[model samples]
Target: MARVRANPQFCSSKNEWKMKNNNERTAAVLGLGMMGATLAKLLLAAGYEVTVWNRNKDKSALLAEAGATVADSPGAAVNAGQVIVMCVHDYAAATSILSQTEQSGWKGKVLVQLTSGSPAEAEQQEQWAEALGARYLDGAIQAAPQQMGREDTPLFLSGKNAAWDQALPVLKVFAGSPEWLGIPAGLASSVDLATLSGIYGTMMGFFHGARIMEHAGFPVDKYAALLSGILGTFGEFIQLEGQLVHQNRFEKSESPMSISVDATARILRQAQESGIHDKFPRYVAGAFREAADKGLANEELAAMIKVLRG
Candidate 1:
């Protein structure tokens, strides 16, 4: 069974003895890109003995100045710390870096991958780490570099339960309360892709809306403000729609398919009349048109999922 641990109200415990030993205070950060650099800085700020390394030696300068030990190689960095955090470009880059480290260096080390990749890649890395006798945890950071270490930062993680327990202290330094999705090793990546899909879809609509404001001689900033103001309410609506889809309840609801059909068609017509780009509106309108044709016009808006499922 998959073990899921998620508590919205959960906060990182401040009990220092949880990581009492000097070894627990030590950490290694590989890859000094924007996000990786931020992670190393956060560890240093939290009184951790941070050892950092990067392909470009120049990237380690700032960290070295901030009291971080700059390792000459990945293996040296891994050997210097009990917990190893890697946040490189991709799985390929990560693998290339790890290849330089000897298997003996990885043995019994807690390796945390904050690199973003597909679920398959995550599973592959986990297998490789386990073969080297390392405890591996795959994580996906949902926020930008500037947003790291905040109480609300959402970091999705998945791995063995033992690894989760061992790395909890180190993980808490990066995220106030990192969410442990399960032990599949790919749950973090899967959730990351799912959330990104929703985010990008919303961004498309926002971009199209911005065009509408520009064409109508209204300030785009005002439209952006409108979006920001309604995020909470809109999120709630999205949650309800998600529930409807999950339950397969397509009966008449607060928002029916007929309403979306009319709204989308009107938006598309307005875009055409204004001589603006109608691609986004046209696509959405087409989907609703198909749903209507399929006799789901009176069903809930989430019934549109059926159209997609086909």
Candidate 2:
């Protein structure tokens, strides 16, 4: 067990006396998939009495090897620990666990859900958990299991301030990077979904580019090397996009709508001329066209989302 002793006064706003008593805290994991397994291992490694429960019995073997106690049912799993952590597939899976666990009693226990879903759905579960006398915390892990307990890994949490403060010390063990998003459970999901979209969208765009590059006879190895460098410089996008989003200011700074639209159109045209399939670049150009059509030709590419969303 790895000892991660935090200061008693780490969360000064909360009762310092209570923080000290949080030691020897037991943790429960309701899922045994990769993400859940990673979480369970972290809790065990951090010296917590970890209880694990998975729908399938075979999934709990590795966790058992790590000195975790397996529960026969989700209710038993939650009953075994003060903190019950869940990262199941979706709302339906959550419901399956919840319906069964509520009968087993979930009073005064902290239920931290790190599952992936929309903000609205998170709130729904939060409300449902509250009705069952459980403290609900919604979280979105930005890092994978391998990054758990390591430095620079980020995880977003949102819930009641008091509950978050109470859980921080125990929760921080598995989270290299942590962001407390405030009382609303849905807020974390909103940020998470936004990030997930950008990540996947970029990957999809890059896939098309990689395919096209391979077809064009560019040594793809160099492109992978070059890709990192190109993406590494997108910090400006975060800054500019934040301002454009928060202030509704979409005035062009670097690449204007007309310029990007023209460039993307050219890329699509080139792909079409080469008898290659091109949808990603065309969709990018389509977004630019929306901004241009709105007479915001001077705005940046990020502004197109706002325009199209509007």
Q: Largest TM-score belongs to which candidate?
A: 1
Error of 1 at 211 (Å): 0.8
Candidate 1 TM-score, C-alpha based:
0.91
Clashing pairs in 2: 153-177
Give me the displacement of residue 262 in model 2, in angstroms.
1.0
For model 1, what is the C-alpha lDDT against the true structure?
0.88
Model 2 gets an lDDT of 0.78
- Model 1: per-residue Cα lDDT over 1-310, one tens digit each: 1112222222122124225655777889999999999999998778777788999988888777666778888999998888999999999999999999889988888899999999999999999999999999999999999999999999999999988988888888888999998879998999999999999989999999999999888999999998899999989999999999999998987898999999999999999999999999999999999999999999999999999999
Residue 215, model 1, lDDT: 87
RMSD of 2: 6.1
162: Cα error in model 2, Å: 2.0
